[model samples]
Target: MPANLPAEAKAKWLRVMEARTPQEKLEALKDFLSSVPKHKGTAKLRAQIRHKIAVLRREIEERKRKRGKRGPKFFIRKSGMAQAVLVGLTNSGKSTLLKYLTNANPSIAERPFETKLPIPGMLQYGDLSIQLVEAPALIEGASKGAMWGLQVLTLAKNADVIILVIDLSYDPLYQLKVIVSELSDAGILLSPKKFEVRVERRRGCGITILGLDPMECKKLGNLLNDLGISDVIVKVSGEASAEDVVNAILGYQHKPALVLATKYDVSRDNFNKLEGACRELRLKAYPFSPQIPRENLKRELCRAIMKALNLILVYVKTPGSTPIPVTLNEGSIVLDLIEKVLGNRILGEVKYVKVWSNRFKFNPQKLGLKSPLGDGDLVEIAI
Candidate 1:
């Protein structure tokens, strides 16, 4: 509704003008949402368009349901020990990287945006199979809802970690800028924060807080009550500020991420610049090429992902079955592993857990649910 709209906005408006159906209009509207500048004057218009988008989406879904088919779904289920998404600009060697790293074949071509959908593959690292998915390119203005941009970001949000594939042959910094900007606008934080905050609504809880000070809890509770959210449990880990808490309440994901600079052999000089810049951004950047030995590449990639995610692998033993590996965050407890592998019902029945680890003094240590677990720990839940 702003008078001085940009050319991009006008182009998107043209799409709206040409839209003949509700579905077409929905897509056009989404396009314009990206086109329109974010400012106080356009807030009302953006809100109205968002409302229309929601209604149209529902209608589309309802029609699909009537026909017994699925609607516009761009979701990929997580597989392997952990899920990591590889995202970057067009022709950034994402498909090529996936081909070399994982056990799935994705079309690699010279054209832009050749890979339309998200492709999933499994990376066999020693005894573990880590799922690595290649996501569609996230272009500039993606957060405002560029062409399938929201869907691309949805793929990123669903992943446990992110690997940004950048082309070393080009100005890798610029590619990183575009991708990082889009991710930031999508509310994805790359760097690991010292603290994490989570809130869950429990109707009768009256705002219980864990791992936080009593005084701060009262302050937070008062704020939540002011916002008509009094039945939520607020959980905090490590140190967090007021802004961090507010960002958490508004919804954000602090993804574990790294940058993989492809075509390193072609642009060896650029790789140093890219790595230096990434270091300044607190992001680790690695050089990759097809000529590198596969086993060494696989090993290095496995180690990098494990370090980036701060993960510890726990091998769970089941009777008459092979031990299953489970990836848990550093400092995860036995109870956390129990619920993940055995489900919630079994947690209450767990008498004690038997753990065998090289770090422990004894061969097998009998521990409780709250006992901390370590990497390569063999666990048996005796319920």
Candidate 2:
């Protein structure tokens, strides 16, 4: 069941949604939490709201500390093909891995939590560049305002891929468990997703519902109405539970992740155990250590991230230019590539596309916009 918030709490939520800045949101969220009734039904909702408040407060205070003093950025912007964030317990070789992959040299100290802010480095694989970011180290309670835990989790939530760097010298499974639990509590899901919902507030799209019966939609609509959510499109999909729906309303994300077992040369037995556990848990794990060659590790890590993200590369040729690489989801068709290569306005103007791939023997195969593109395909568009 939903929170079934009272009118006062609902009004407070509206103000929270309307809030523009961190300080404004912090104040509004605090006020909203006060109005929420204390009960078993509202416990999870209150916890999520409190987490949001803590994150906002931290952001505000961080900005204040950085006021006019140019500091290393806390918020990292995305670049290159995709963003792959590195997260692990302190001193798990995240900084060393970043240093090996990219030119950005972060301090690689023996002490834990040496990397206070998010560090970014670029990994070049063939012709593609994937952005690799090392997040601040995580502690047990990082999700609930433990020394920049929420910030690190937020980074993971926004990233296209998550790299769980674990040390084989320690209990790899235990470290992995703590990191996954913290991420799960912060609404950043790494395991297989069982629920998905999208709620959008759009004008003229009045009370639209999908994937639910009329009565269920009506009940859900009434719940949203109580919270002043009108003219909204609520899309529900997958095997969702009541709690899943509530978490969706609270804004949760699913991420694709893999594990990199560091210091693997130290203990093969530990690595073997971790690998077996990863197989059972449906996660991919790789071995890493100082003994292993760094260059080969860089290439292997880059390709792994691409595959984990399920991304593909396609080449587009212009009239007077050479074919250039473009990235898209693995199963995207030619039209999807066209819309990206040429803007949506050009969709109607395309006459056809000529594609060349290893599957075809001829010089070029004539394909329509709907034609499926394979990896490393060269395409010429006619308009």
Candidate 3:
């Protein structure tokens, strides 16, 4: 041991020693690599750490290939307006966040992998409730069924949102790499600058394209033909390239994701490192801490989730009462809200609605069923 090592380096080494899971240890090892002082005296120690990290990575990959079949224990039923899953390496404060955000009381411990199964919790934000499920720790090679990762990913595919719970107390950037790589391999993409391709198959009609050039459309059609698909209507949106077209044709969907940097108060330097890394990777990281008041954390999380999911809250009133809030997608119309709140019965009698949209430069206007609703719109139904 180096006698003149920095205090932060010593603390990271202690975290590595206290780590109880492979993924946690991997994160600690990375922290140690960054914290250690660079000098001739520590060259041998740095080399050893690098070698161990490489060896552990290989071992984790091997275990992934050797894992057996998974059964029904990993199922999660999503409730509320949207569902979000927390994915990260072990001991990333996922369980702690879960306890704070939802009604779930998962067994919290100082050890890694304390959560072996999927734990579901409900996070209520205003009139909207989101289902937040904490998945088992995801390690490298998780897409290949490493640590039953495929099972957890299966649940993620069904979720409307994916919230990555990163531990800023350690090497959150590296842990994020592991999580993103695994999710990508499983055909789950998380990008705020994401593109969407809509393919509508039409009988006996040649491929028609919208929002893309003719050449791009022809290329996409060829790709789809190779997959035995033909006669389709394809619409590309949001800066989609050739590669994005192919991915969509192959049943790929762009999923919205948010990053939550846990234990932000533990170390400012570590938090900064995480934020910079996420920015380079085109991800936005939100700060989270159990040490802070629970309400504050929840409000921040709700805002992030709403942004990721492209959702807005709509307040609807019967006539003489406080507006009842209902959550809906950003482009939702008045008819959609009526269907969600008042059901089909209201559709028969309601002709128009009076709305005050603070989002747009408009006064209280009477809108038809097809009129779009904005965030925080106060709506009144006229029978």
User: Among these predicted structures, which one has the highest TM-score?
Assistant: 2
Model 1 weakest 10-residue run by lDDT? 222-231
Q: lDDT for every model? A: 0.79, 0.80, 0.77
Clashes of each: 0, 0, 0
Q: Backbone clash tally for model 3?
A: 0
Candidate 1 positional error at 130, Å: 2.0
lDDT of 2: 0.80
lDDT top scorer: 2
Question: Residues 210-286, candidate 3, lDDT per residue (tens digit)?
Answer: 88776776676565443334456778887876668866653355788888988888865787788888888677888
Q: In terms of lDDT, which candidate is stronger, 2 or 3?
A: 2
Q: How close is candidate 3 to the true structure, as a TM-score?
A: 0.71
> Which is superior by TM-score, 1 or 2?
2
Candidate 3: give the clashing pairs: none
Once fitted onto the true fold, the runs of candidate 2 whose alpha carbons sit more than 4 angstroms away are 1-28, 37-52, 63-69, 104-109, 114-117, 148-151, 191-196, 200-234, 238-241, 276-282, 291-296, 319-321, 344-352, 361-363
Candidate 3 residue 92 Cα shift, in angstroms, is 0.8
